[model samples]
Target: MLYKFFVKYLKPYKKIVFIAPIFMLTEVIVDLFQPFLIQQIIDKGLGAGNINYVIRIGFFMCILSLIGILAGLSTIYLSSKISQNFGGYLREDTFKKIMSLSFKNLDHQSPSNLIIRLTNDVTQVQNLILMSFRILVRAPLLLVGSFFMAFFTAKSLSPIIVILVIVITVVLYIIVHKSTPFFTNSQKALDRLNTVLNENFTGIRAVKAFVREDYEINKFDKKNENLYSSSTKASLATALIMPFLMLCVNFGIVASLYFGGQFVIGGTLAVGQIVAFINYLLQILVSLLISGMLLMNVSRAIVSVKRIIEIHDMQPDITYKTETVDNIKGDVTFDHVYFKYSDNDEYILKDINFDAKAGETVGIIGLTGSGKSTLADLIPRLYDTTKGKVLIDNKDVKEYSEKSLRSQISIVLQKAILFAGKLNTNIRYGNQSASDIEVEEAAETAQAKEFIDKFPEKYEKFISQKGSNLSGGQRQRVSIARGLVGEPKILILDDSTSALDAKSEALVKEALANEHKDTTTFIIAQKISSIKTADKILVIDAGKLISIGTHEELLKSSELYKEIYESQLGKEA
Candidate 1:
């Protein structure tokens, strides 16, 4: 699975991946030739007392060293380019997949988990690719080349090289195997820490209000401790590989010197030959040590690959057909709709049935946890019903392309989310092609123009992240203007006016009725006064539709309606 994913994203950079290894091999070959050249300069030039031969061979060695340096540099350059590009592609595609997911799909995963996968996990895989093209390919080839050359140079001492190689390989394998699970655990710990941090940062105001600083600190400490322990375990395991490898290499070096000294005294090997053999032994050991370190990265990358692939494997719960539909007239119907977050969970909305004509205003009022927002979410197919169907303009919403269905509907969430950009850009999010006049008119209708005009830069004024620079009512009004700018046929406001004063709310409502009379609107509110003037009001209780009627009719007929009206209106009622 990991290989297939790499092949898909890295296909465009195949030439670089291929070319990088060729340069690495060139560098390795050049390194291997150095010991042999030194052997010739020592035996043929120094021992034979030939000054010209030593100088000639020494000059050639310098040229080869330069060539090796060039090859190494080229290898590093190409490997980094390929790896960075592959990481960029992988991160972008994973984020796009997350954006395409349905609300139900997002419910199963946390945003922090996705953020870690896209950034940290992608980086792990990228480092592996970079190492593969550099040390990973070079180390094994150098080890093998040194072994063969050691045998060819002095067959008698080759057995020592063979034994130490086998021992180091076995020990490194065990260390890597024992550490793989710890690395996986470490990554999970990091995810948990990120989740906790994200929540704390987003809700810092609430934490301060509730005086829960110590509680939050304790929570973060727990996650931090888990991450610290897991990382220490993985790091300590990997740290052992180098010291053990060096111990074995040092023993091999001592043994080679002892044996090679005997062979040199016996006249079977010359002084130069012994020197060359020890050099080859060191080369083999060094390559193995480098390879052992790279294996740790490879193990971590394998875990990261699995994490990333898990997201790509998910099939979104909501999918649209290829068929396109014309602009809908905002006529929405929910037929026997039932919704549960998951199969094992209890239903949030049960057997819900309702209809709204084009240009009609429907008010939904219910207590918290009564699935008011869930029913509003159904019209845009944010989540598909567990049973029955949602229809827009007399056709099943699932039959229309997602673009076609979403283009006609605009929803202003209870929490008005705004990005960091100019006021114009935030408002233009609803309709990028809207004219300046259209933008002004929408803001005016949303009752936001007055406050916006107070700013020095007016429409071009910059907004902070989540609109932190604006007051709560100002943010909500701007969000409403954004929804209105698109001129969507259906506009759903889920408690969007709760922050506004009665006068502002009334003015906003009056503007909507006068300017957007052809557009259907669903206003979900907790206050009776907010929706009392609606053409039709639907009352929900614990996920069931308790009553559907005009405000006067519901007040007269429904007990729940009268109780809520009296709670808020009292003697005025």
Candidate 2:
């Protein structure tokens, strides 16, 4: 599965991948030639008292070293370029896939986990690719070449090389096998740490307000400790590989030198040949150590690849049609709608049925978790109903393309979210081509113009992330202005005005009535006063619609509506 992902993402950079390994091989070949030249200098040039010959061979050896340096530099540049570009493309595609998922799909995963996957996990895979193209390709080739050269130099030394190789291989295999699971656990711990940190920062205001700083600190400490523990265990396992490799290589060198001295004394082995043989043995030792380090990286990359592929394999629950509609009349209907978050969960909305005509105001009132926001979400098709259907313009919403359908409906969520940009930029987010006059008009209708003009830069005033610089009411007003700038036909406000003062809410309502009388509106509010003046009122309780009438009619007919009105208004029925 991991191989398939690499193959798919790396298809575009095949040329770089192919060329980088060739350069690595060239460097390895130059390194292999060095000891042979040194042997010739010692046995033939120096032994025969030929000083000029020694100089000639030494000069050629310097040229080979320079060529090896050039090849190594070229390989490093190409491998880094391929890894970074591949990681960039993968990150972009993964983010796009996350954005395309439905609300239900997004709810299954936390934002922090997704962020970690895009950043830390992608970085792991990129580093692995770089090492594979550079050290990983060269290590095995050097190992094989060194063994052949050592045996050809002296047949008696072949047994020592084979014994050391077998012992070191066994030790490396054990270290990597034991460390693989720890690496996987460490990655998971890192995800948990990110989740805790994200939640702490996002709700820092609440933590300070409630005087729970110590509690939050303790929570973060616990998560941080877990991450540290897991990472240390994995690191310690990898650390053992290097020391064991050095021990085996040094022992092999000692054993060869002692045995080669005995052979030289017996007049059978040349001193120059033993010197060349020891160099070849050291090369093999270095290559094995590099291969061991690459193995550790490979294990971590495997875990990261699996996590990334899990996201890529998910199929979005909602699919769109290609059909386009020239105009939408802003009429919406819910026919026997039933919904639940998942199949195993109990239904949150049951048998809901309602219709609102163009230019009509429909107010929805419900207790917390009574499906007010869920009903508003259906109009935009944020989540499909488990049963029944939603219709717009007398056609099933599923018939229209997602872009065509959502473009006509504007929704202001309960949470007023704003990005870091100028006030004008956020407002223009609703309609990118909105003119300056239209921007002012929308802000006026939403009651945001007064405070906006108070700032020195007016519409160009910069807003911080999540509008931290603004008050609750100011942020709500800006969000409303953003929604109105598009001039959408169907506007759904989900308790968006709760932060506004009574006077401000009244002005916003009046502007909507006067300036956008043709647009259909759905107002979901907890306060009875906010929605009492709508053309029709729908009362919901425990996922069931108990009454549908005007304020006066509902007061006379429904006990729940009468009780709520009396509680808020303190009036007798």
What are the models' TM-scores?
0.98, 0.98
What is the alpha-carbon lDDT for the whole of candidate 2? Answer: 0.91
Give the per-residue lDDT of model 2 (tens digit) for 406-445: 8888999779999999999999888899999999999999
- Cα lDDT computed for each candidate against the true fold: 0.92, 0.91
Model 1 scores a C-alpha lDDT of 0.92
Model 1 lDDT tens row, 128-205:
988988889999999999999889888899999989999999998999999999999999999999999999999999
Over 4 Å off in model 2, which ranges? 323-326, 570-573
For candidate 1, the per-residue lDDT at 453 reads 94
Look at candidate 1 and give me any clashing residue pairs.
Answer: none
Score candidate 2 by TM-score against the native.
Answer: 0.98
